[model samples]
Target: MKKLTSWALIRQNLSRKPVRTGILAVIVFLFSFTLYCGTVIGQGLSQGTRTTAERLGADALFVPYGYDAKVQSSLLRGEPSSFYMDRRFSEEVRQEKGVEKVTAQLFIATLKASCCTLPVQLIGIDPETDFVVRPWMASAIDRPMRDDEVVVGSKIVGQVGDTLTLFGKELTIAARLEPTGMGFDTSVFLEIDRARRLLLASELGPRLNLPAGLDRNAFVSSTLIKAAPATDIKELVNRISQKYAAAYNLDFVVVAGMITDMAAKLSFFSRCIHVFSGVLWVLGALVMALVFSALIRERKKEFAVLRIIGASRSALGRIVMREALLVSLSGAFAGVAAAMLVTTLFNAYIGAVLDAPSLEPGPLYRLAAAAGALLLGLMTGPLACLPAMRKLGRIDAYIIMREEL
Candidate 1:
């Protein structure tokens, strides 16, 4: 008789219990899939919150009070809108005790600005006195932005020097900003004067609700502010309210507040998801332990025969370990495949539900995450067999064989 090789014996053992092994593998697959998804979601939450805060770059924002909802919507959706405020109040806002710098912007809605022919939000910033918009483009844009020139968002499907036509005015795409995971990714930034020229030249002027003979330079949509050092932002808000009383309707969007809200809400939601995954993991481990224990009991007669053939106690344990390892490894790979597919297919929808502006982590980060998850899954199998291993030394194979006889 040919001596059975270790691999052959292990293969035969697994074939004999196909049903049990498959069930165990399926459980691992489900547990691993849920855990991996939770990890990716958490990564997205962190990335979205940080990107939003850094992109806004304003300590505080002041917009038309009654139209606060509209302002927020425009910023979030990157849709063009028309609203006007007295540009003169900018000085008053800057002169406030806790205010450091103040700048105002004009937001114009355009048709056919987006590559897909959707409306695009065009933001105009004063190059001479601007701090917010220009700084974001510092790394990408080297020179002054000329008339008929624009800086496109990272999401815009074009490169530097690409020409895009908006409202019949040709715009040279001078620079492109990195993704902010928000409306900024979809907006076009250009010189304030150039924006004013385009608005005044366009046929949509009358429909934009501009005052008769309005001075473009004298109107602004909202004021962006940077508060002074050690200033209590809440107090600064109060001052802006009192000082600009009746002159402007004020709706303040503090950067700190926005970040706090985003972080808090997402953190809470992620925790709940993780807890759900955790429960599944524990339940899977429990089922795995029970299954392995029963497997050892049912195979007692087989173990006794192997012992009679001179197979040691340690050899039997090794066989059981191999079965568990094979089940775990197969399930882990399957789970990872499922998770990758789910994240890729429904990430956009998931991002929306989680209020994560974007779920685009860099390629390197994604690769590392996948590798880590695979390694973690590999370890779970050995861990699941610990309870069964403890009973291996005391399992009396000979006594069980005699009772069966």
Candidate 2:
């Protein structure tokens, strides 16, 4: 007969009690699955919030009065909307103290655009004055966008060189930007001059009911402001409110303030997930301990026979620990694999359910999280079996056999 090595003995032990081994493995699986999912979601929310702050690239946004929420929805949720205000307000903001730069964007919504099944947002920006979108666009396009060309967000349906039709005019796709996990992902960007021309020529222009003959250069949806270094943003906001609040009917969306609020909410939600995962881990460990203790009693006679056949106390203890290690490793690998698959497949659904911008974590982050979960999973088996190992070490072959008789 082949030699019954330690590993072979472990395999025999596990195979003999397949149902019991399966139960122990399942407990560890549940713990690892919850931990991995929680870690991914927490990391995603934090990354998304950081990316949003960077992408905003403005100290404050100025939009038509009572449209602050609409602007927020469009920016954060990829919702399409159209609105306009006098572009003169943007020029005036540029002259304010503490204002380093001001760039205007025109918002237009296209209904059933050729590029998408649903409406899409069209943003017109001036490359010369734009600080927000242009910096991000550099990664996608090497040169400035022409009046008839457009750069699209990652989530937009078409590829570079594809043509998109909007409001009866055709535009070429100059480039496609990387995903930022923000509303811009579904938007089309073009020169402000072209956007102004499209709006003027389209039927939507008359619907605005502007104050008699507002020139194309006079239309703007919003203005993004960059403050001078070390400038007090609050004071700048107060000054703008006092100067243009009444005259231009302007509302402010402080980029920093929005990010701060989002971070706080994300932090709270992350904490809840962690706390719940911790509880599940503790419960899993306790249940494993109980099942292992019971397993020790049932295997007493079998272990006594091994001791009688010349197996030392230390050898018996090793057998139990090796079994535990094998089972734990098997379950841990399965759990982590399942978690990663589910998260990747339903990532968009998760973001919608959480009602927040969420970026998938990078590969390094994912690898680290998997390592942590596997470590915990590996520890669970060893820790739960420590007491059982101690009990097996003190077993008396003669007494155990007599009792069995």
Question: Which prediction has the highest lDDT against the true structure?
Answer: 2
Model 1 compared with the native: what TM-score?
A: 0.86
Query: Looking at model 1, how many pairs of residues clash?
Result: 1
Considering only N, C-alpha and C atoms within 3 Å, which residue pairs clash in candidate 2? none
Per-residue lDDT of candidate 1, residues 339-390 (tens digit):
8788767754676666556556766776776777677666666777778877
TM-scores of all predicted structures: 0.86, 0.91
Candidate 2: misplaced stretches above 4 Å?
1-5, 15-19, 200-217
Residue 37 CA displacement from its true place in model 1, Å = 2.8
* Most TM-score-accurate candidate: 2
Lowest lDDT 10-residue stretch of candidate 2: 208-217
lDDT of 2 at 128: 82
In model 1, pairs of residues that clash are 80-109
What are the root-mean-square deviations of the candidates from the true structure over C-alphas?
Answer: 3.2, 2.5
The per-prediction tally of clashing pairs is 1, 0
